[model samples]
Target chain A: DVKVTQSSRYLVKRTGEKVFLECVQDMDHENMFWYRQDPGLGLRLIYFSYDVKMKEKGDIPEGYSVSREKKERFSLILESASTNQTSMYLCASSRGTGASYTFGSGTRLTVV
Target chain B: TQLLEQSPQFLSIQEGENLTVYCNSSSVFSSLQWYRQEPGEGPVLLVTVVTGGEVKKLKRLTFQFGDARKDSSLHITAAQPGDTGLYLCAGDVTGANSKLTFGKGITLSVRP
Candidate 1:
């Protein structure tokens, strides 16, 4: 079955370290998104890409950057990880406007 | 920014009971979606409603979109242990990125 795949299920990062989280989808979708979920905050979008090499900042993109080098792969980068940045990160892909999203299993990152 | 507000942040009920959760938004959305997420997993799409005053049913679950396309509701006929999860409502604004604005979500626990 078609699915979105995240590179890691769980990650531990040190404060001030640079971190990378990868996501790939096999459905050939044109849109990819990265979101960080926290308690009482729901899912806050960090970044989203509608096409290859195209990226747009979401509501909470202060500490995060994203790359969409290919049609099926989107990557989220943390320039400098902090303790407050630790949260459940999720990746998702969709066909186009008004389309349903297929999400990866998610990565729980703990920063210390 | 568009925001979806979900009511009853937490709910606990016994099996065979019925439940209804509300999602309201002041901004009119082009489409609305409902998602369910279990522990350690990403949110999965449960249903999507695009038309105003639309109602859809999936087995024991029912979803309704408001006449103005600004709100939605989800109702379960018979809650089960397997129905326990985080329920989120998302609204898609008419834009190029098609980024979705999500609600804080409701945590439902069904006990046997």
Candidate 2:
């Protein structure tokens, strides 16, 4: 089975702290994405990478940055955590454009 | 407003009831995908619809893509407790990296 692994299930951080949410996929897919889920807001894309070291901003990337140092791993960084940033983060990977995404179990981050 | 819009933001039904949810857009899509997210977990891909007017079924669930390729629908028959979750619809805007959008998901609760 295809597997996408996220490093944390739950994280609590204080405002202004730097937070990193890690994700690793074993499917050898070329496209990876980071999305934050909030009630009523659904899942809003934060950042995505099409290849190693290639990152693009998504709909809600204003307060977030992403890293794709390797093909199998993508990282989402919250440079300065804020209460508004507290949400469930999801990581996904797909073979390419127009394909379905395989997602990790998600990391629920709480910025207090 | 989202590029894709899902109707009935929340649905609560009794077990064994039948329900249908919709995803719509004015812009065309290269492909549309449906995902289900349970509590504490990431969204999981349920199906993808690419061709216009295409219909696909997975056990008790049926998915259909509009002939214009601008909308989709998911129908669940004899809903069970196991069917409870947040249903999300996403589309690849012309199947590209910079334009894919996810709709505000519909939360379904199957009461026993």
Candidate 3:
């Protein structure tokens, strides 16, 4: 079975703090994505990487950046955390474009 | 902007009941996918409908894509407590670099 592992399951940070969320997949997938899930807004894409060292901004990429140093790992960075940025973050990997995406267990972040 | 809309944001029913969730869009898509998410876990792929007017079944779960490729539906028969979760619908638009557009999820609660 393919597994996508997230670095943290729960995190709390103060306002103005920097945060990092990591994801690694063992499937040798070519696509990786980061999304934030809210109660009524659904999952909004923040960033996606199609290949190593290449990243693209998604709909809600403001204040967030991504790094893909290796094919199996992708990282989401919050430059400065704010209260409004608190939400459940999800990571996903796909073998190719238009293919089924396998997701990691989400990381719930709370910024105070 | 491509957008997918899901109806009935929340539904609570007794076990053995039947229910249907609808996903609609004005723009046509190459494929539509249904996912179920549980607490503390990532959303799992339930089904994918690629062809217009296609119907697929997984045990008690039935999925259909509209002939125009602009809509989709998921129907559950004899829903059990295990079926309680969040159901999300996503659409993959045609053309290269197709990014998925997700709809606000439907929260389903089944009571015994």
Predictions: Cα RMSD each: 1.3, 1.4, 1.2
Model 3 per-residue lDDT tens digits across residues A1-112:
8899999999999999999999999999999999999887789999999999999999999999999999999999999999999999999998876788889999999999
TM per candidate comes to 0.96, 0.95, 0.96
Q: What digit string (tens of lDDT, one per residue) describes model 3 on residues B1-112?
A: 5388888889999999999999999988898999999988999999999999999999999999999999999999999999999999988878748467788989999999
What tens-digit string does per-residue lDDT give for candidate 1 at A49-98?
A: 99999999988899899999899999999999999999999999999887
DockQ of 2: 0.71
Model 1 chain B lowest lDDT segment of ten = B93-102
The predicted structure with the larger DockQ, 1 or 3, is 1
Give one digit per residue, the lDDT tens place, for model 1 in B1-112: 5378898899999999999999998888889999999989999999999999999999999999999999999999989999999999988876634777789999999999
Local accuracy of candidate 2 as per-residue lDDT tens digits, B1-112: 5789899899999999999999999989999999998999988989999999999999999999999999999999999999999999989888355435789899999999
Q: How close is candidate 2 to the true structure, as a TM-score?
A: 0.95
Which portions of model 2 show Cα errors greater than 4 Å? none
i-RMSD values for every candidate model: 1.1, 1.7, 1.1
Instruction: Give the Cα-based TM-score of candidate 1 against the true structure.
Output: 0.96
Task: Report per-candidate DockQ.
Answer: 0.79, 0.71, 0.76
Q: Report every candidate's CA lDDT.
A: 0.93, 0.92, 0.93
